[model samples]
Target: MRLTDMAPGMRLAKDVYDPNGNVLMRSGTVVTERLVKALRSWGIDEVTIEADAEDAASAMLDPKTAAEIRALLDQQFSLSNRDHPVIQALYGLCLERALGNR
Candidate 1:
């Protein structure tokens, strides 16, 4: 998963390593915002993580379809406070629905 996808409470599925091959985190470490910040500082871009069923399903969403759905959602939510946490979460739920329907 990329840094953009990482979230607190997600569990690592494998060890994370630095460029020099130093282990950063062992498997099963619960992700935290601070840890994500540290990884960004270390220039780590991606790490494998255990996926829940919803995540697994979302991973199967086609890129083109997902983009299209997001575009549609953006238009639908154009008037809302997109920066608000509630708005962002609602957007996520809508995107999930849009993709899952296909």
Candidate 2:
């Protein structure tokens, strides 16, 4: 969830950690206005929130969409050696950007 869209009383779906690896807020913590402000101050821009079964299902990529995304990624990286670590990382970034936009 976007930090700006989050409201008071929403429960976190995952734990939030600081730059130093300390847990800032545990999973299942109920959000508060103060906590939101603190998160913003701490440079947190987004977070996962608990969702219903339907929401979780809808969030997933269907097989067709997954295949399309995979094909597109493959075409984009066709000229690069898939075994190279840097190319692999770039492909992952491309995949994330494509999925996020969709």
| Top-lDDT structure, candidate number | 1
TM-score of 1: 0.53
- The candidate maximizing TM-score is 1
Candidate 2 lDDT, tens digit per residue, 10-52? 7887899988998999999998999999999998887766654
Please report how far candidate 2 places residue 95 from its true position, in Å: 16
Q: How does each model score on lDDT?
A: 0.78, 0.74
Off by over 4 Å in 2: 53-102
Worst 10 residues of 1 by lDDT: 48-57
TM-score of each: 0.53, 0.51
What are the per-residue Cα lDDT tens digits for candidate 1 across 40-92?
99999877666463365576787777677778899999999999978866776
Error of 1 at 90 (Å): 30
CA RMSD for every model? Answer: 12.0, 6.6
